[model samples]
Target chain A: MEKKQSKLSIVTNGLLHENPNLRLVLGTCPTLAITTSVFNSIGMGLAATFVLIFSNMAISACRKIIPDKVRIPAFITIIAGFVTVVMMLVQAFVQPLYQALGVYLPLIVVNCIILGRAEMFASKNGVLDSALDGLGMGIGFTLTLTAMGFIRELLGAGTLFGIQILPDAVEPMAILASPPGGFFVFGVLMALAIMLDEKQGRKVDADPEKIGCAGCPNSKNCHGEGGCE
Target chain B: MLVKSSPHIRDNSSTQKIMLDVILALCPAILASAIIFGLRALLVIAVTVVSCVVFEYLYCRLMKKPNPIADLSAVVTGILLAFNLPSTLPLWMAVIGAFVSIVIAKQLFGGLGHNFANPAIVGRIVLAVSFAGRMTAYAYPEVTNGVAALAGATPLVATRNADLPLLTLFLGTHGGVLGETCAAALLLGGIWLVVRRVISPVIPVTYLATVAVISLLAGQEPLVQLLSGGLMLGAIFMATDYVTSPYTLTGKLVYGLGLGIITCAIRFWATSAEGVSYAILLMNLLVPYINDLTRQKPLGGGKRK
Candidate 1:
């Protein structure tokens, strides 16, 4: 990614520099839906991370074998395989989280982050690099989801991980546990991420829409070839 | 080297001046709230205003943007947010509402004119959802000092055909939220804003008229519908928000009509006793489409539907 890239940087990139959620703005559907509680977010993050790592590894290893034109379908097939495994594992061991995540667990197969990384990073990089990238992105996604969940759960319920934090005088705002609060928290965290990026001497894009839609691989088919226009 | 943008012909009014005019218009409602809800009304307003200003100032400072508090928009947001809350709402809750209004609704959307919806209305809706029990608890208005001595159902909940004197409703000598109870004061403030050319009359006039028409058609008392709830306050101030309401006359009429229908539906059929805030909020989300639909065509001809 740079003049002096290292194995560690590949992993760390996903955690901070190129966070799938904060920087790439990928996998937003699951990110917003399952991030209402820290417990649920951590569970979702781990499950997605597992799927991303295996999918990236499998895709990178088969990159030479798979044709370029049919790569999206191939990559999705690989990711969906991993998602099924993880979904089953969660259902078997963590029944509560399985219930909490509900439909989102299966929907992770289509999360842009996994498919985006497989196509953009994995298809080009070595197996080691792809696995590291998956781990980093997973960690970053997990951290972001947890942060949102923590803030939302704290404000919306006046508790942190079910522990009382705020004083009795402070009334909890229950709306933060809902959809609009999810959007608000997401926007605020994005603004914070942009600011943090600037503080670290990195050039983050000022335009949110640009950052989101710029590197999207499916841009050519956006709105279905002239959709609503 | 006059590097200028569109609307080259400008008026003397500034954002600050326009905001000041709005604040002036809101004064009667604020006074009414104080008289009807007592010292706590002023307390909630003060807390919300101070917090809104502080949050905006801190966000700008931390983000290294030019301070935006000078526009006085935060103050207006604070007043309006307070207007939407019950007087008995804890000061901390009001502060949270202010934060949502200023930090989330206003600043996050790129501040001031760039906001997608009315910040105060967003704050109110957020607070209402988060603290539903506290937000809905209405206190009976005191005859002596206007502060409620105890909690009670407002006219909206009193009975199916609750009939208080029109004068009492007009004067706001009843149990309700801080600013919504007083119809006369709200009307006065609205008229003043209209006189000062601060807001277009289309939204308020059409919104109120639609509510009246719906009330009569629904076999309810139109005057009671007009006088009893937050209809006047929302029509005058919240729904007429320059940023959230439609710009064109046709769009405004549509916006008003939609608002009226939503308000009536919510008040009559929905579980909520008042629907003005939710009505304005829903309409705020639709303003952009309404503007697009009703945009003025070009001088000769424009694209057709």
Candidate 2:
């Protein structure tokens, strides 16, 4: 009963407050690549989410057994196990999506969001909380990618998920569907997200720390007592 | 009048006055663009200018900041962006260029003084990259000899490949962007800006000198290289932007030299026709580091060992 009150906040935090794509800005490699279409965005998001939940649960369950010294390797091994499962499931079921995602599906094993949460939240939290965090963050990533894909596809290709959206007169900007197009959409979306936060008297500062901390060897170690946020 | 309540110093120039001076200085080139490219070019300029000012104002309103269109900076950016575009470019595309200039490059980076790079250059590059086919479709004015040669290609490419005469290239009787064709007019406008003291001669002089010397050494006619494309306009205007270029003279020299070298490499050997825009953009990004490297010592001298 006591944990239930904070449960809602944790999920919401992943959805809005600490969204992996917009707020956390993790898993951007996949986001930029997969956001050309709504289907790819949803597929990638769900696949990553599935991997996240299981990995988080697995990591949480073994948190005590895994030593602090080699926890990173252990976490990777566990996450890789789930990612392999996801790759197999997608290949067997949705062959087209598997083909579309290509090497990226296998590349999901190294996604920062999964590895990041494993280090930050799941390792320190209970199974239920970890699962919810995965779900919320996954949904947030899904929505962001879908929105970007929808805009890019509509403007760049004049179609949405292979359906014609714009009329023939409007010559779509094909660049929006390319890699640079992905960046433009991602930038516009990020700006809008920051602006919305500002409207509520809170600012979303794109501090370099969040992204920089991921690859840092001393991420776990604070400068002194409480580490850099 | 509005004097401060203490020991104070002041300068007569403000953002508005500087912007106004730039606009005045740009008039000669603007007139030349109209004369050379025709009335359609004027339409592009008007559309871009209005859209840029409106976008700036709307952005300010949405962000709940005071209106910034009064500064006339947007107007200057508009003219510069229009100057980069071909006369044949669609008006809606010009509007897109304005949005990119004011909103993405200007407002999103917290406006004017805080913007990372020159907004006009970014806007023009974005448009160029996004619509390469449209952006490069330079509309040639009625020139007798050049009519058979590239009816729609920019002169930089044609000059390299085709047997285009240096005289024709010098006299601006070829297809190119609005400001690039008229070397004489750009020189006049650049001289006016220099005389007005709105900018120092450091960036433009160094940039042009580097390009000329390198071009001569590389066995290309320096005057032909100088007069052919947007080199004069860009070296004069875009490279000398207040908020983006380096502050120290040493920093400005390095930045200008870098730009010149890049521009020469791209034009002589690379695939692209004109590299002035990209050269300036890249150098603009390096301004902070250049400033640090060329930072002036204190008047009394306190240097780090």
DockQ of each: 0.80, 0.56
The sequence of per-residue lDDT tens digits that candidate 2 reaches over residues A1-229 is 2234388777876766567777667889988997788778788888998998899989988998999999999999999999899999999999999998998888888898898889887888888988887887778877888898889888887888889989987767767888977987888888777677667675445655664654432244232334645
Kindly report which residue stretches of model 1 are placed more than 4 angstroms away from their true locations once superposed.
Answer: A1-5, A67-70, A208-229, B1-10, B143-151, B159-161, B301-305
* Docking level of model 1: high
In model 2, where do residues sit more than 4 Å from their true spots? A1-5, A198-229, B1-9, B149-152, B299-305
The digit string of per-residue lDDT tens for model 1 on B1-305 reads: 88688888879998899999999988998998888888888998899999999999999998789998999999999999999899888787888889889988889788998888899999988888999989887666766654332336776665364577688888988888888989998999899999999999999999999999999999888988888878888999999889999999999999999999999999889988889888998999999999999999888896767
Error of 1 at B187 (Å): 0.8
Worst 10 residues of 1 chain A by lDDT: A220-229
Worst 10 residues of 2 chain B by lDDT: B144-153
> Which candidate comes out best when scored by DockQ?
1
- Which of the numbered candidates is closest to the native, going by highest lDDT? 1
